[model samples]
Target: MRSEAASPILAFHEELASDIRTGLAGPGQKMIPSRYLYDDLGSALFDAISFLPEYGLTRADERILRTHARDIVGRLPGPITVAELGSGSGRKTRWILEAIARRGSTTYYPIDISRAALTRCALELGQLPSVRVEPIERDYLRGLSEVAARRGKSDRLLLLFLGSTIGNFEPAQARDFIREVGERLKPGDGFLLGTDLLKPVPTLLAAYDDPLGVTAAFNLNLLMHLNRDLDADFDPGSFAHEARWSAAERRIEMHLVVRRAHTVTIRGLDMRIRFEERETIWTESSYKVEREDTARLAKHGGFDCLSQWVDREWPFAESLLLRR
Candidate 1:
């Protein structure tokens, strides 16, 4: 984990100790933490999902950012530093970073929990003439304090939160996070935030459960990681991947279901576990936010909303928020 990602991510990791213990002692105990979903291979697979036709979130979002990046930079007043959360693969980030550098005076600070992703992106980004890469190896939540501390008196900041990753946080947590981030900026600073919006259950389901079955393979990758890293015996083939849309939360939840009664061993912890058929492990939640809810959260975060741009069909929305 990036040391800078924050205490909350560590808190979650510690919390997992309790969950992992509970999960092993009894049948149908607790769900696995979502953070474990990105074990190198999971990271690469998710990056591939960005290109899949069914997952239109990434492409549509990039379109808006690419179209209006100059406008966003212009509206920011001048000479801003660009800081991003979850700056994965540095694909869309290149646009905003380059835009800031085009002005001849700007810096890019990218914070991600993955050191490998950060190191690779930083190496590539360092090649730019006017760009200086301040790569942060920390979870976004824990690293927010350092982000606030790094701000200078004369700086205007542009915060990039693309990829709809914001959708992963629960509403209350999302509200708290946005508010905290807003408190760290100046009046002219802005957030170019991307979010996946409400959609048909089928459309949403397909995005998570692609025809290629790559998503399933992605979820099971976690089990493989645990076996390799934690010295656990998880028969990846014995479990099935499940993805479903939760209408109440308006999100997609991924689960891993044990297909048959089984026993497994954790060599690191010297523990044994038994699973029954149909036993499931919750892995991730991807929430789709309504416009009003998003705007209200932004307002509470001390931002005056400037604009919200959705796709041609309104499947997603990218909002431009100026700090108040």
Candidate 2:
């Protein structure tokens, strides 16, 4: 089993060792962890892709948050502390913090894996008098362990799981993530969840695999991350980004395919890997959820959906739930 105590330094060391052995030695292929895709450059590229017309998930989810933030925040019914999981750019989170502050004084908590991103968001959010931005640099999977260590107030916790990050995982994984949130939250606490609703399969596919090929570049950026972080010779030009819709899974899948047969080396790991032409490395999968499915997941994890709202234009949802 993987040790939870593996700090980023240890993780980096393991990656370096693996890369040196496999990345530089010879041509072999393996899946790269999607977690590395958000280094500064990749995060900025993702922000750009979010603005593209083809990517409607971000905008649609933002609209739901903007339109219903007040209603959702109003449901809290008491002084609240807001916690956001997987907060990327921290754009939409600002709206929620403000909304909750207006209703009652608020203390904002933004949890992310990126320390730099957290600091940037913390500095920007500090301006609001009601917003006390505590940046927690840890994976959301750990939930409140580190967060609880930092926060002693023990106030009612409200979660902001926005931008359809919930879709990034499969059903079981999503349930587990929510259950972790439930475990950390008190009975009166709430979990505000965001999800992309089921839509036309073509629409879903196009969102990840766009016509202008921006999505392609976004998908292939994984190789750039691997090369930079793991000291591996991953030629970005050698991978053609591919996206496919999995009917059984009801999600859009993103992959980076080897452009041609090749070998690469990672010096630290002393490993070499081979790739057949067109062999693909899967990167991400975003699952679409219906209201019933979303509610079921939340309820089974020890919460009941209080209210759910959808965007007027596209099928996206923001659900507010209270611990059961």
Model-by-model lDDT, in order? 0.79, 0.77
RMSD of each: 3.2, 4.0
User: lDDT by residue for model 2 over 223-275, one digit each (tens)?
Assistant: 77667666779898888888888888888778888889998775445557777
Q: Please give the lDDT score at residue 87 for candidate 1.
A: 80
Residue 209 miss distance in model 1 (angstroms): 0.9
1-324, model 1: which lDDT tens digit per residue? 666445655664555556677655755544776667775677778888888888888888888778777767777766788888878667777777777778876777888766677787888887877988887766675555567777666887788888788888777888888988887777878898888888888888888888998888889998887787668989999998899788877889998989999998877667788788898888888998777777887898999888887777537887889998
lDDT, candidate 2, residue 17? 55
Clashes of 1: 6
User: Native-vs-model 2 lDDT?
Assistant: 0.77
Off by over 4 Å in 1: 1-29, 183-188, 267-271
The pairs that clash in candidate 1 are: 2-137, 4-137, 4-138, 5-138, 5-139, 6-142
